[model samples]
Target: MPKVRVHNVTISLDGFAAGPNQRLDAPFGDGVGWGDDLHSWFMSATKDAAAGRTGTDVEYFVRGDRNIGATIMGRNMFGPQRGAWEDESWQGWWGDNPPYHHDVFVHTHHLRPALEMNGGTTFHFTDEPLETVLRRAFDAADGKDVRIGGGAAVIRQYLRAGLIDELHLAIAPILIGRGERVLDNLGEGIDGYRVSELVSSPNVTHATLVRR
Candidate 1:
């Protein structure tokens, strides 16, 4: 069966997935000491791979993209804009050619037409329930897997609904005093998941959890 999975989700030592005050200029938020070096090991690995480097980080980073046919992310991950999207001119941060080369669903209350970019990526904005959107993603994915490309909150909702089949967390060695946390207030929602694997590199520790 095709699985609903989250991969390469990086969090800080303090459990913050993103910094406080997320906005246009500051994508990960302001006053979080975010820079080229402050990103997760997976981010660094992407750059390193381009420079002909290979390591554990690169290995896991590459694994995240394998067999992912569709993506589901929150509105924040699509952009920093909020409140009904007054302007539809913004085409996301990835420019004309986005990274995702498949159907990318953005979870939002406001409705918007499907956006077809230069690459194979098509952004579908919807306010549908998690299960409904996920079903659409599965249909688009065919027999491949659906990735939970998140901004924390959306992932939490799927977790709460017990929709996720697998999750991969890359814990960075930094601390964001205030921001969104990836694993908080789940209560019994996370009961069905278990840590299936744990590995560490020089910059981060990787943890893989699967439904028990």
Candidate 2:
């Protein structure tokens, strides 16, 4: 079976996964801003003059996204929207074609209908537990890989639960002062994993971990 993985989750030197006060304009938070400068490496590496991905980024991008059939993300990662949603008009942060061209299970507090978007992306909202959600995602994956897409809190949940088999982090070069930190309260639960691969570039440091 394909391992549960995480890729390209950019973080500040201070360990902040996202900056504070996320809104329509500043989705990643006021610090990183909506543009997500942390993920700038990915954006620059993938896009070309043709207006779409056309380069070595294709190999890396495909390896990260195409190998997976489904993804699970926290509600906040889906959008800056909070509470009861107020309405269903909000699809997600990505307009029309989302980056995840596969089934995406969004963990939410409030119940919402499944959202079908352009490309192969489909969002399924659920308030289920970690195990329940992963089971559903793996089932939807149809023998392909499943990913626990993150925004810190959710990743920590599964990480502590030993749900993730492979983990990748794109440690960006910046500090957001105060925001959501990815390594908070992990304690010894993090000891089960060990770094298996690492690479360095001008943009960022790519670290891949595997369970020991």
Best by lDDT: 1
lDDT of 2 by residue, 82-123 (tens): 898888999987899997889999999998999999999999
Q: State the displacement of the C-alpha of residue 20, model 1, in Å, after optimal TM-score superposition.
A: 1.3
Clashes of 1: 0
The alpha-carbon lDDT assigned to residue 124 of candidate 2 equals 98
Which portions of model 2 miss their true places by more than 4 Å?
34-37, 48-60
Q: What is candidate 1's CA lDDT for residue 163?
A: 93
Which number leads on TM-score?
Answer: 1
- Candidates in order have lDDT scores of 0.89, 0.82
lDDT, model 1, position 189:
94
Q: Cα lDDT of model 1 overall?
A: 0.89
The parts of candidate 1 lying over 4 Å away from their true place are 33-37
Clashing pairs for model 2 are none
TM-score (C-alpha) between model 1 and the true structure: 0.95
